[model samples]
Structures are given as C-alpha cells and as structure tokens.
Target: MDMDTFWNDFQLVRTGNPLVLNVTNHVVTNNTANALLAAGASPIMTFSSREVEDLMKISGALVINIGTLNTQDIGLMHAAWSSANAMRVPVVFDPVGAGASTLRTSSSQELLSLYRPDIIRGNASEIMTLAGEAGQAKGVDSSLGADAAVAAARALAQMHSCTTVVSGEVDIVTDGNHVYRVNGGHALMPRVTGLGCTATAICGAFLAVNRNRNEAAVDAMALMAIAGGMAGAMAQGPGSLQMHFYDMLYSLKKSDAERLFSVTRD
Candidate 1:
C-alpha cells in the first residue's frame, strides 16, 4: 500500500465524516470519542442492547472494545455485531486485557466465536492469549514485544479469517498472508491511559472509508504511530502528550503523513 492510498482514505473520513459506532470501555469513552472527532469521524458510544441495532444501521463502522466487560455488554456486542453484519458494515474488535483474567479471556473468546471481526487489534500479550498461546499480560499491558507474537497473530488471522494487529514498540498488522510493520510511536504513549483503546476507535474510523481490511488496518496503525510521534516530540510528559495527541490528529495533513509514516510490508 502506498501513502496516496492511505491519504485518500483519510480524506474520505474528513470529507464524509462517517459515523462510527463504538461499544467501547467506559474508562476511555471520552478519549475515544475525542480521538475519533479529531480524526474527522463521528463517534457514537451507544452500548445499550435496546438501541444497538438501530444505531448500527446508521453507522459506517462498528468498534467493540472489551476493556471493561459485563454480561450486559456481551449481549449488546452480539446485537451490534448482528446489525453490523446485516448492514454490511465493518467491525473492529479490540481484545483488551485478554490475558489478565479468566473473565476477560473468556469474554474475548466468546465474542470472537460470535462474530468474525473485520479487524482485531490488541497488544502482543492480548493477541497471543487470544491465539491460545502463553503471553505475559500484566494488567492489560504487554510484557513481551510485538515481534514475539507475529506468528501467533498470523495464526489468529488465518483461523478467524480476519486482519490481526499487535501493537507494541513496533506495531504489526497482518492478514495471515501479508504482514505490515508500522514504526514511529513515542514512549510516552503507554504512560497515558486509554491510548490503546483510542487506537481501536481510530481503526474503526479508517475502515469506515477503506473497504480493504488489511489496508485499512495498516493505514490506521501508521497514522496512529505518526500522530503519537508528533505528539511525543512536543509533550512534556504523559499529561501534555494526551492533549497534543488530539491536536496532531486534528491538524494532521497528507504531507505530514507521507513524511512521518514509517511502514514496511512483507
């Protein structure tokens, strides 16, 4: 994929302002919504099962983040997935903290079984755990590098027939056959809360305009890394990084993306 392809897709989001339905965690709801808005996409956080079907009909894409899960949330996710599938809308799944506890792991697995997400994004440990491998996940943080889960991510993608993304120092995106590596994120990213969740929302925004799952995943990750790098440069710490991150997303231009994006495919 070329920078032009990514830029064109991004422009679609800016011009169209597609609605992205998010059944995400409450902890990062504000951050995710702000990030989506900054990237020129409309975000709707309606997780109620009663309203999900209607919301999914109008949404261009759906995002499911299992960061903070509940029994009711699972039902809502199923409803949203069904509606999205019927509407032919793309769905992005984030298996947050999959290896942290049995509840989290089982919930993630159950959702995967219910729906084959167009794209699945998670850290190395979460991806590995979802792939039925042993990964070191300490309270939603990946102790292992993203490279360590490349094979596991590829296998997961093949098994689920979906694009898989493992985010770490280097972000890795794959669709079982092709792999793309995105590099440029800052160290301060992990220090802030909800950035990973925000990344998942951004993926939904990208997929709203780009139909190709692999290209959409790669483009979203590349943009996130570029924006994170730019924000990190000016931030004094995690606090300012959070503020600058949104600024970067709002002010991000095609030229900046072309110059800052560091993506390699194999």
Candidate 2:
C-alpha cells in the first residue's frame, strides 16, 4: 500500500485499538507501553508463562523483545512465540543487542530459527550480526551503517522468510521481494536506548490492525520515522524529545503522516 493507505491502517488500528501482547524486557517496558497507547493500540505487557498463551489467544498480535534476556525469560518468549505463530498472529522480533553476549546472540538466533517472525527491526550492527557478520557491537547501539548491510539484510530476509527492517540515519524495510527506504528522523532517537524496541512493538500494533501486514509494516516504519523527526524539531534534547515524542504520536493524523512521509522503493 502507498503512504495514504498506510495512514488509513493506522487509523483502523487506532479506532480498532487492537490488543497487542508484548513479551519485552525490563529496560523498554514503559516506553513500549506508552508508545503503543499513543498510537491508539492496546498494550498488554505480560511475561508470565502461565498467562502468555492465553493472552496471545486473545490479542491481535505478539511482540517479542530481547531487551532483558535471562534463561527463564527466553523460555517464556519461546512459548509465547510458538503459540502466536501457531495461531497465525503476526509476530515481530526485536533482537536488542545481538552481538553483545554469546547467550543473547545465540538466543536471538534460536528464536528466529524456531519461529520466523513477520517482521524484525534492528540497527545495522545487529542486523549484520544476525546476518552472520563477525563484527563487534557497542552494547545495543549499532556499529554498522544501514547501507553497508543491504545484502546481508536481504539474505537474512530471504533465509528467514520474514520482513527485515534496518534503522539508522535512514531506515530500510524489506520483505525479500520489496525493499523500502525511509529518511527523516531526529538525531536524538539513537540517544534513547529503548526507542528501537518501541518501534518494533509499534510495528506489531500495526500488524495487529491490518490483515495485510506487509503494507501495515511499511506504513508503521515510515510513520515512526516521521513522528521521530517532527518530535525532534519540537524538543531540546532526548529527555524532552521522549515526552514530546508521545505527544506527537498521540496527535498524529493520517494527513500529517502522508504529507511529511518520505519513502522510496528499490
């Protein structure tokens, strides 16, 4: 779908207020929940293995975030993902810091191998590592460029049969067949560590509302970048930007998204 229709889906998601189940880490729980509500989606953050399957059964989509990884959390994430996939609910995966630790990196890959997600969002270094690069990562921040790993992203997408999104100065979204690049974001976004995880959860909310998530994912990514850009202009720095970011998200109109959106397909 084009940008206009993308906004329509966001509106549908807003009005429908699809219930999105999140199995996220400790670091980004608050940001992720706020972002989901700001975008007019219901956020349900639950990690209890006892209730995860039941929650996924009722929710619109499932979001798995590896922001805070542990042995037990990994088991719950795997169970939630398995249930979500079996039910055909769109699943989004965020491998927060893939190359940071052997356990984190291995768990991320294991999840992907076990249940390929509908969409996966991460920075260049994370994507490159997920695509089998040997480069080191600086904590969760990307040490690689978005453009440098296009081939790896594509390869990963095809191999996993899942849409891959690489966000940097410019964001790249690909579904193995189609690739879109979105430019227009604030520099302050990277300063906030959990923003990327928030974006992945936002993508899950988008997939929840639209039946065709290929288009919904595209729109979600573009709208997120656009919102970040606009909010950056209105704020002093990352602190204020975080507060202003939610305001922009809550006030976002479909018209604004279409008007300011910058997209290109390659």
Candidate 3:
C-alpha cells in the first residue's frame, strides 16, 4: 500500500467530515460514534424507520450493525439499508456475533439476501459462518484465526460481489479477485469492547471518500492496525489503550503509517 495515497484519503475524511448514517445496535453505539468522530466522520445513529429515507439524503455512507438485534430494529435496519441503496450511498455491514445465535445468523443472512453491502467486516468465525463454513464462535469472538477464514472470505466476497474484511492479529481484506493482508494491531485491541465495531464504522468513513472500495477497506484496516500498534505501545492497559487509540486516530500521519504499515498483496 502507498503511504502517500493512504494519507491523502485520511485527510479527505478529516477535511470533508462525510456524514455517516448508522443503524447500529445499542451495545457499541457510543463507542462506534466516538471512533467515527476521532476518524473525522460525522455519525448519526438513528433506527427510526420513519426518518431513515430522509436521513439517507445527506449521508455519504451507511453502516448497519446487528449487535443487539430485535424484530422491530430489524425492520429499521432494512429500512435504513433500502434508503442507503436508493441514495447510492456506500453501505458497510457488521455482522456482529453472527454465528452465536440463530436470530443473529438468520438476520444477517436475511440482510445480505435483501441487498448487497459494499463491504462486510467481521471476525474470522463470523465471516466463516456467513460463508457457510463450519465455524465455531465463542459468542462474538472468533474461535479461529484470521488466516483460517481467507478462503471463506473470498467465497463470501464472490458470492455477494462485494468486499469482505476479516479482522484479527493479521487482518485480511479481499474482493474475491484480489487479497490484501494487513498486520500491525496489538493484542490489547481485543480487550476493549467495540473496537471491531469501530473498525467497521471507520471503513464506512473511508468508503465514503475513496471510489476504490477495495483499497478503501484496505486503508481502513491499515489505519486501525497502525493506530492500535501506536496506542498499545503507550498504553499500560485497555483503558489507556482506548484513550490513546482516539488520540492516534485524530493525530495519525504518514510518518506513523511509514513506521507501522505492514501490508502485502496476495
């Protein structure tokens, strides 16, 4: 990945502050919103089906998370997704804990069947499960490694005709035809709740600016990995890591990417 191009895209978000409409769950709502602000994207979290279409008019991107799914909220998510599709805004889907429950898995499948998401970001188990692989998820956490889900990610991408991101110690971003591996994040990242959700939200921000959806997803993973590495180095624990994470996101520069950006095309 080119650091100059990546820096330019990050600056676009900082300057443009693209509005991102999120029909996300309550569990990680505040965390994801704060992450979007740190990444210089405006976040609007509203699940009201009545106003989803109106909100999509000004949104540059839409992110739908099924972390805390319910019947009523599913309708709202579908409404938001429909509006996003109609508006031609990029949609990023986070199938949180997809394999952990029948409802979560079925709801995720339902959404995918209804409309194709521009990008689908999840952990190894979630991606594997979504791809119809024999994946075992310990609740929302992936029981398998990221590399174990590469084939599944590729299949899922090809099946849906969209990008798939599998997050782990080494993140994998694939558009079925091309695959990119990003390595830099720390173990402390998973200790914090909603960091994965934050990554999905940040992907939406990058997608809003970059026309190349594949590279946009790659850059988003790169940003997370590099920034997480920086924050982990300075943080004594997960609490400080979260604080330093926001700081790193707001102040990230090409120099930081130069030092930590480790990506390979496969």
Candidate 4:
C-alpha cells in the first residue's frame, strides 16, 4: 500500500469517525488514550466483564493488549474476548512479550486460539514466539530480525486466519497472502517503553474507521514508521523523540506523512 492511501485513512478517521474500546494493559494507558484523541477518534478503556459484552456491541472496534496481564486481568480479557467474539466486533490483540515466559506465551496462544482478532500486531520476536519458535524473550523486546520472522508471521496468520503485523526497523504485515513491508522508523523507538504499544493503539484507531483489516494493518504500520522516522530525525535522543514524536503525530500533515512513507510489497 502507498503512503497516500495511509494518509487518507488517517483523515478518514477524523472525518468518518468510530469509537474504539480498549481492554488494554496499564503501562501505556495515557499514551494510548492521547494518541487516539490526537488521531481524532474516541478511546474508552475498560475491562469489566459485566460491561464488556454491552460495550462490545456498541463500539466500532475492540482492542485487547496483554501487556500487563495479571490473573484478574486475564479473566477480564477472556470475558472481553468472548463478548467481542459474540458481537463480531473487530478485535486487535497486541501480544506483548508473547515469548518471554511460559505464562506469557501460553496466555497469548490461548487468546489466539479462542478469540476472533481481526488484527494481531507485535514485533518479530513476539510473532516468532507465537509461531512456536524456541527462544526466550526478555520482556517485550525482540531478539529476531524482521525478515527472519516472515515465515513465522505467515504461518501464524494462517493459523489464526487474521492479519498479522510483525514490527521492526522495516516492519512486515500480511494476511497469509500479501506481504507489505513498511520501512520507516527510528532505532530510538525501541528505546521507548510504549512506542510499540503506542503503535498498537494507532492500529486500533485506524481500524476504528477502516473496513479492510489487512489494508488497515499495513497502513497503520506505514504511518507509524513514517511518523516515527520524521519525529526521530528531529529528536536529539529517545527523550527528545518522546516529545517530538507526539508533536510529529499531532502536527503530521497528510502530504508530509505521504512523503515520509516507504512501503513496498515483495
């Protein structure tokens, strides 16, 4: 997909808006909320099983990020995922650190096997782990390269029958068929805690408006890469990039965003 196509979707989110319900983790709560608002979509964070079914029925999309999962939270996620499934609401799962520990990998796999996520976004290592590649993940970071995880991503996408996003310096997105590579991002992004999670939220925002899940996933990654790259260029370091990245996100002109995008299919 082209950057202009991606830019148009961002504009569409502002114009033909949708409500996004996030049953996400706590680590990047504030960042996720702000990013959604900046992108011109409404974000509501709640994991109550009581309200989840009703919420799922009402919201345009439902997002589940297992970033900070506790026993109670996992229960809530299962309930929320079930509710989302019943309603067929677009579900986006960020399996953060899917390969970190037995618990994390198991929980993520359980979610995938049970839920109906329209999109799954994570770094290469996380995707690799989900593909059952034998490796230990140190928290939510990736030890695998982007290209190295392509087969795993393809397999996982086929296994889950959903659009999969494998993030990296040059991110790759697919749906068991088409593979779109989004090559635009700063190395400093990994230095930040919630940037990847932030990207998940952005995907949530785009999915709020876009109908085609694969295109939306591809476009969201392109936007992240382009915007992060531009913001990083202006940043002195990760600290500066934190401020500049949001500024770039808010001040991102469609034309400028298009110019920065560099996605291709192989």
How do the predictions measure up, each by TM-score? 0.98, 0.96, 0.98, 0.95
lDDT of 1 by residue, 14-51 (tens): 89999999999989999999999999999999868898
Scored against the true structure, residue 227 in model 3 reaches a CA lDDT of 89
Q: Candidate 2 — which residues are off by over 4 angstroms? A: none
Model 4: colliding residue pairs: none
RMSD of every candidate to native, in Å, equals 0.9, 1.2, 0.8, 1.4
| Model 1 TM-score, all chains together | 0.98
Weakest 10 consecutive residues of candidate 4 by summed lDDT: 133-142
lDDT: worst 10-residue window of model 2: 210-219
Off by over 4 Å in 1: none
Pairs clashing in candidate 2?
none
lDDT, model 3, position 253: 77
**lDDT against true structure, model 3:** 0.92
The order by descending TM-score is 3, 1, 2, 4
Cα displacement (Å) at residue 72, model 1: 1.4
Residues 177-249 of candidate 2: C-alpha lDDT, one tens digit per residue: 7878887889899887688888899889888877565676677887778889889999898999999889888
